[model samples]
Target: MADTLQAGDAAPDFKLPRDGEGFLTLADFKGKKLVLYFYPKDDTSGCTAEAIAFNGLTGDFAAAGTAIVGASPDPVKKHDKFRQKYELSFPLLADESKQMLEAYGVWVEKSMYGRKYMGVERTTFLIGADGRVARTWRKVKVPGHAEEVLAAARQL
Candidate 1:
């Protein structure tokens, strides 16, 4: 397993395909606060709810000088469907190789009903304008998560 990232650590760089087309990188969010969240899959119950919560707060996040981006191992096509289905206001990154997920320490071994496998850990990283992680929420529960993240980002 990879060492978990913490506040003050430098956020990892990634060049990933996004929902519509083109790519986004960590540098794209430089000099701005960012909510970089990693989820298990697109269109899943928890993931959809989380995305909607964030989407609902998009204007608020922007007012706080923060940008929100979501990442998952699902492909760009899936991301497109998911984003359209929810009318998500932010970009959803595709990490099909799981490389970015591992670098962020979100890809991990999970067990459900005694079936063990690798998947995203439902994590969120609040990165400051300096590119250092300001806060990290691991094993995140969906309920009120976006509001919590917005509060934290506002503090930053």
Candidate 2:
């Protein structure tokens, strides 16, 4: 596992494919605050709830000048279907190689039913306009999480 990034550290730059489209890079939102979240998979229970919560609050995030983006190891095809299913208004970056997930320290050793596997840890990072991490939530719980992120973004 890589060292987990802390608040105030420079956010890593990445170029990943958007859902059924071209690539998106960190620099693409350089002038705006970014809510970058990492999840295990598309259409899963926890992941779906988290994405839907953020989707419901898309306008509030926009009003706060923050752009929301989700990342997962799923392919662009899966992302496209997930977005369409949830009506998510934000881009879901396809990190098929787990590059961005590892960089963000969300990819981890997870145990379920006594089986060990590697997957995303349900994390979120609030990045400031200057590209520094302003806040990070590891092992995130879906309920009311987006609201908490919005509150944090307002402070930034």
Candidate 3:
């Protein structure tokens, strides 16, 4: 695994498929704050709740000059369905190759029922317009996480 990124490190750049069509790149968020969240799967209970919470504060985030994006190993088709079902107002990135997830150090070993597996660490990064990470939340809990991220983005 790559070194875990910390605040003040240059945010890694990436371009990945997004829901609907076309792609989203780190450059797309240049000159603006970005809330990039990595979750384990699409449409799962925790992931869905996190997406909805972020979606619920879309206007506030926009007002703060921030953009919210959720990424997972799921493909574009799955992302589309998830977005539609939740009425998400932001982009859901498809990181099927796990490149972005690894680059950001959110891909790691996880254990459940005493069995180990590789999966996303449910992390969130607040990146400033200058491309530096302003804050990071690892092992994120879904409850009030979007609001927490929004508060950090406002600081950026």
Q: Which ten residues in a row have the lowest lDDT in candidate 1?
A: 1-10
Question: How many clashing pairs in candidate 1?
Answer: 0
Q: Count the backbone clashes (under 3 Å) in each candidate.
A: 0, 0, 0
lDDT of 3 at 58: 95
Over 4 Å off, model 1: none
Give lDDT tens digits, candidate 3, residues 57-116. 999999999989999999999999999998898998999999999999988998999999
Query: Model-by-model lDDT, in order?
Result: 0.93, 0.93, 0.92
Q: How high is the lDDT of residue 12 in model 2?
A: 90
The sequence of per-residue lDDT tens digits that candidate 2 reaches over residues 54-152 is 998989899999999999999999999999988889999999898888888888999999999998899999999999999999999899899999999
RMSD of each: 1.0, 1.0, 1.0
The stretch of ten residues in a row with the least summed lDDT in candidate 3 is: 1-10
lDDT-based ranking, best first?
1, 2, 3
Task: Return whichever of 2 and 3 wins on lDDT.
Answer: 2
The digit string of per-residue lDDT tens for model 1 on 75-112 reads: 99999999998889899999999999999888889999
Pairs that collide, model 2: none
